[model samples]
Target: MVEIDESHTSLPVLAFFRSPQAGRSWVTAAGLVLDTANLLFSALDVPRSRQVELTFTAGCLAVNRVQRFFDKKAETQPTELRTPEEVAAANPGREAFAKVWQELRDGGLPVRPDEEAAWQHYQALRMRYAPSIEFLSQLLLAPAMGSLH
Candidate 1:
């Protein structure tokens, strides 16, 4: 199952896929998580991918748990959500994500440890923005988001 306490960068992805969506089952959601991970892993090194790997593994694991619950709850036709294989096969970024997600299925997702200094840089950015975030919260406003991660 997904570790609920995953890194902040991937937290939103984890949160979204883990939720029970209408029409979509665990299968499709898991792929979406991978696609997002592939995107992040490909683009962002400034924030490091620690949370990326952590949350990807955690998110995939969480989605995995939803299938049985989905199947058991069916009244007539069980939700015909696409399988992970189907989703992976059809996605545009399959070149990268497919290998990873498939490996994930067999406990093959590689763990790339985030550099300690790089992680601290993101933490430092968040700390620097803390007051601004607090001010927005105090005003009942959402602060502008940054790429702290």
Candidate 2:
């Protein structure tokens, strides 16, 4: 088991270790919705760019659905935020996000030159909108948690 050394870790990374169950559930739900959209898009003869747009829309819808489900659940059952250590104990999504981040850093995740600007803009907006550690975790870990075994 890998022990997270919080002293050396940034706040954003530590945030992923905070809500394992919610993170996993939200991610799985979003992945299901996105996968459905992907299948539907593949069957149609839409242009590649249009397909990408629709996929993005599908992802947004997934987030909204997850938020709604959890919000209602929250009303009936309050949840306390877990500490980083507690969350990391059973959370695989944190490590998965770390691996993906490393892959991006090593240039393993590539974007075409034509799309580089759009990618950068999207990243900037992501950071802008994710104003807190918890918010950042939801955005980063959801997809990762959904994909994990």
Candidate 3:
């Protein structure tokens, strides 16, 4: 067994990489949806650029689904806010957001279709209304195989 050093700055990231059952259920569910989206879209005779667009769109949907699940969970369970402020108060600086993102990704909750659609629209607005911030967030949370695995 790889003894994961919990003290590492990337501990939250490692938490996400651990067994799929341990953390949030949303992450795994979103991953499944993304995989399905990829498979479904790959068969279409779309242009490469279109395919990439579709993939990014699907990913946006999947992430929104995850967010909805967490939102609902927060409503029912009423856990502490995992926002940057709260996380920063505990861990400080980038480490806080990193940890929160890891927690959100590892939670593995299920997102509904409606929620996914809403998220897509929200993402579009963000892209249009606040391109720089949206782009920065994307840069911060660049998807990687390890995040899903």
Clashing pairs in 2: none
> Mind giving the per-residue lDDT tens digits that candidate 3 earns over 24-69?
3323333434433432333222343666555546555535533333
| Candidate 1 Cα errors over 4 Å, as ranges | 1-22, 60-89, 93-149
Q: Give candidate 1's TM-score.
A: 0.30
> 1-149 in candidate 2: lDDT tens per residue?
01122221223233234444454543344344443343233322334467655555645543443333334533322243545553453232435434433444465444233333433443443332122222323444433323322
Where in model 2 is the C-alpha error above 4 Å? 1-26, 29-48, 69-149
Instruction: Tally clashing residue pairs in candidate 3.
Output: 10
lDDT per residue (tens digit) for residues 49-84 in model 1: 687777656654444333322324321223224455
Reference-based TM-score of each model: 0.30, 0.32, 0.26
Off by over 4 Å in 3: 1-48, 73-149
- Clashing residue pairs, candidate 1? none
The best candidate by TM-score is 2
Worst 10 residues of 3 by lDDT: 1-10
